[model samples]
Target: MIYTVTLNPSIDYVVYPDEPIQLGQLNRISKHHKYPGGKGINVSRILSELAIESTALGFVGGFTGDFLKQQLQDRAVSTAFVEVEEDTRINVKIKGESETEINGAGPHITPEKQAELVSKFRQLKQGDIVVLAGSKPSGLPGDFYQQLIRLITEKGASFIIDTTGDELMQSLEHQPFLIKPNRDELEELYETVIDSKEAVVQYGRDLLNKGARHVIVSMGKDGAMLFTHEGIYHGSAKPGRLVNSVGAGDSMVAGFTGTFEQTKDIKEAFRYSLACGSATAFSEDLAVKEDIEKVLQTITIKQWEE
Candidate 1:
């Protein structure tokens, strides 16, 4: 079984203003929508689109948490979130001339609640994949993710971490099954600018040397590259308008991990990763099966060479 952990989930409230947003003024929106918002949640939602069953695990609370849970349930996604005292956060995304976001800090998780969440992982067995994504809520220990990784590793289950900076760097030592870091995050990780494909390949290989079993460096419209012990592969989707970029990376992670888990084909997983990401980028929300199928028709993968 696959499990996705979202330590801090939210209700992404997207509002489209009739006109450009003005500062410190009464602004009105033409339309709005809300959905469960968290990196891990996005992965689970995308996995569902591929007919892959994954249980979402994380912290959720209050009326807001209730809504987020129902949203996932409505989408036919299973969840096992720990309830907290404070209400789950609401992130406001203003889509005007450009997208602007105001994110909430999320609820504080007490140690008792933290231990309760950790106990759930003890049930995991070999062949299980746990995807740990998004940021940690306030008041938890800094090593919270590391603690979970230890338990997961001890249980013989694999993990995939989608985060940045030190937290991401720290997870590398555990030899995660996969890690998807974008071009910018890559540059930030090594503190060097990637001006050419060679630079991208260099840093990507460095990540592999550092202990990542498989590394995928996403370069947005420029496409993505997959680095494995066997060889390197690259693929991209045909050009299309960008509607939303919120869950594109999470969609890619879900695509590659779910497909590879089932088929164990790296190239096919890379292809689906590109298609899933592109489909999501071209839609207002995460792509569905039909959308993924349509985009998959335009995807092609080839050996990446200098």
Candidate 2:
């Protein structure tokens, strides 16, 4: 079974203005939306679009948490979130001339609450896939994910991390099954500018050497690269007008994980990853299966040649 963990989930409130924003004045919207927002939750939603079943496990509480749970249930994604004391957060995104965002900090996850989450983690068994993504809530230990990696590794269950910076690097020593780092996050990891394709491949290799079994780097319109122990492969992004990019990366993670779980084909996984991301990028919201299929028709994957 596939399980996704979102430490700090949220409700993304996105608004589109009919006109430009006026300073400190009420702005009417042409349209608006609210969706359960968090990396792992987004992955589960996208996976459902592909007809894959996954259980979403994370911390949720209060009315916002209840709403997030209902949203996922309405989308047919199974969930088993740990209820917390604090309210879940709300992130507002106002889209007008440019995007403006105001994010709320979710409830403080106390150590007791953290232990409750870890207790749930104990249920995972061998051959299960667990996705650990997004940021840590306030008061949680920095090595939280790393510790989970160790526990999951000991259980013979493989896990993937969709995070950046220290949270990512700290978990590397546990040898995560995969890590999805975009080009910018890659640059941040190595602390330098990634100027060329060759550099991208090399930096991916560096992560491979450290501990990651597979390193997939998403390069937006330029497409994405997949570095496995076997060989390097590339997947091209399908061309489309950008609508909203909020869920693109999460879609990529879902696409890769769900496809790979079904077929165990690395190349095919890379293809789906690109197509799924492109699909979400071309839509106002998360892409459905049909959208993904449309983009898939335009994607072409090939082994990278040195």
Candidate 3:
């Protein structure tokens, strides 16, 4: 079974305005939509749309949290989130001239609440896949992901980590199965500009040297490069006008993990990852199986066997 961990999840309230948004004034919304959001939650949603079953684990509370849980169930994704003391957050995304975001801080997770989450992690078996994604909540320590990875690795489970900055840096010591960091993140890690594919691939390799078994350096539109302990692989992004890039990376992680679980083929997995991202980029929501397959056919995966 595949398990996804979202430490901080929310109800994404996406508001579309008919006209430009005015700052410090009441803006009228033309349309609105809500989705079960947070990086790992998005991964589970996309995985379900691709016909892969995954259990979403996280902390949730209040009526808003109930709504978010129902949203996932409505999409046929299994969830086992712990009930916390505070209400879940509602992230507002006002879409008009450009996107404007106002994010809320959810409930503080106490030691007992965190222990409950760790207990859930203990249920994973040796062969199961676990994905730890998104940010650490305000109340949590920076080493949260590292601690989770250490516990999950001890269970002999394969893992995928999708986060940036120090949290991501610290988790590398656990040697996660996969880590997906976008171009900007790559730059931050190396503290240099990545202007060429060689530079990106080299930096991804550097992460592997530091203990990550597999590294995927994603370049929006330009495509993504995958580096394993064995070799490197490349897949190009599909040609299309991006409607929404919000869940694209999470979709890519889902696609890659889902395909890797089924085939254990790295290149094919990269194709699926690129396809899923492109599909999500071309739509307002996450990519479905049909859209992902269509993009999959157009993506070519080349291997750098050396």
TM-score of each: 0.97, 0.97, 0.96
lDDT by residue (tens digit), candidate 1, 1-306: 899999999999999998799999999987999989999999999999999999999999999999998988888889899999999999999987788999999999999999999999999999999999989998989999999999999999999999999999999999999999999999999998998888999999999999999999999898999999999888899989988888999999999999999999989999999999999999999999999999999998889787
Worst 10 residues of 3 by lDDT: 297-306
Which model, 1 or 2, shows the larger TM-score? 1
Query: What would the per-residue lDDT of candidate 2 be over residues 109-226, giving only the tens digit for each residue?
Result: 8888888888887888998999999988888888899878888988899999999998899888888888999999999999999988899999999899999998999888888999
The model with the greatest TM-score is 1
lDDT of 2: 0.91
Clashing pairs in 3: none
lDDT of each candidate versus the true structure: 0.94, 0.91, 0.87
- Candidate 3 local lDDT, 175-261, one digit each (tens): 887899999988987789999887887788889999898888889888888998778988886589889989899998998898899
Error of 2 at 269 (Å): 1.1
